[model samples]
Structure formats: structure tokens, C-alpha cells
Target: MAVEYHGFRVTVDAKADATDTQWLCRAVLEGVEAQSETAKLPCIELAIPKLKIDVLMALSMVEQTAKQAIDEWWHARQPEMA
Candidate 1:
């Protein structure tokens, strides 16, 4: 699943682990221009450290984690106030 957040695109990939006992998730973030909707930077991949037995719960965690990652990324690029 993919969603737009903070002028960027976040794509989430979730699947069961090798033993099929737990779910693992990762998110790919790409910079996108608002006007043209084109990529502006290389993709950033983040591994979400959340394990769950249910797929729905895992997906929710991944989405929330991705959003927080995007927020931190955006804040790091901004100039700090004196």
C-alpha cells in the first residue's frame, strides 16, 4: 500500500516471516514534487521494528511508523530557529 505524506510518497510492504508465525514490515519513502508529482530524491527504505500476529495490526503499525519517519526526515532538513 502507498500513501502521500509531507510531499513524499510512502510505500509499505508487509509479509509473514519465514516460519509464517510473525509479520514483518518495511516502508519505502520517496520525495515527490507536489505540482508535477515527480520523484525528487532517491528512495529511503526503513525497516519497521514491529512484529505482530495479525496482518491488519502489522499494517497499522507500519503506516504509523512510516509517518513518524517522514516527519523526522522533514524536520531534519529544516533550519533551526535561533
Candidate 2:
């Protein structure tokens, strides 16, 4: 449902509707592709698999954040224009 990042690049994404943590993680990766330069930037960390995954994978996605998810991703990839 959303992407969170540091290191001047996006890192994590959170989702609730996904069937599992891994699925949500993939969705985040896909979202980054659709919404950011993630597709172009091969070095983005979105592909790293989580080792200590949380059992509470289902998250209450913030409607506000979800709505802005695309914009947030775009910003991360193009902060200068944002």
C-alpha cells in the first residue's frame, strides 16, 4: 500500500490486502516500478527479501498514504522536481 525509504532512495513498502508478507513485498516492488524510477534504477533495494519476517503481515493501510503512494514513490525518485 505504501513505500518507505531512506538513504536517498526508497527501501520498504507496506501493504495489508496482500495474501502474505512476501506478496506485499512484491507488490511494493511492483509499485515502485509503476510509480518510481525503480524500474530504471537497478540498484534499488526493493528486491532484497526480508529474513525475519513479521507474523502480523497484514497492516491497516492508511487511506491517506495509500492515496499518495504513487506520488511519494515519484518523489523519492525525483525529489528535485517534487
Q: What are the RMSDs of all candidates, in order?
A: 4.2, 9.8
Q: For residues 1-82, could you state the per-residue lDDT of candidate 1 as single tens digits?
A: 8998888787877876677666667777777866325534434433333342466667677777778876765676664821
Q: Note the Cα lDDT for every prediction shown.
A: 0.65, 0.38
Q: Model 1 scores what on Cα lDDT?
A: 0.65
TM-score of 1: 0.68
Candidate 2 residue-wise lDDT at 2: 41
Task: Give the least accurate 10-residue stretch of model 1, judged by summed lDDT.
Answer: 44-53
Candidate 1's displacement at residue 47, Å, is: 8.4
**How would you encode candidate 2's per-residue C-alpha lDDT over 1-82 as one tens digit per residue?**
3444322233344443343434243223233323443443322212222344442342223222333454565578699978
Candidate 1 error regions (>4 Å): 34-53, 79-82
Error of 2 at 24 (Å): 15
Tell me model 2's lDDT, rounded to 2 decimals. Answer: 0.38
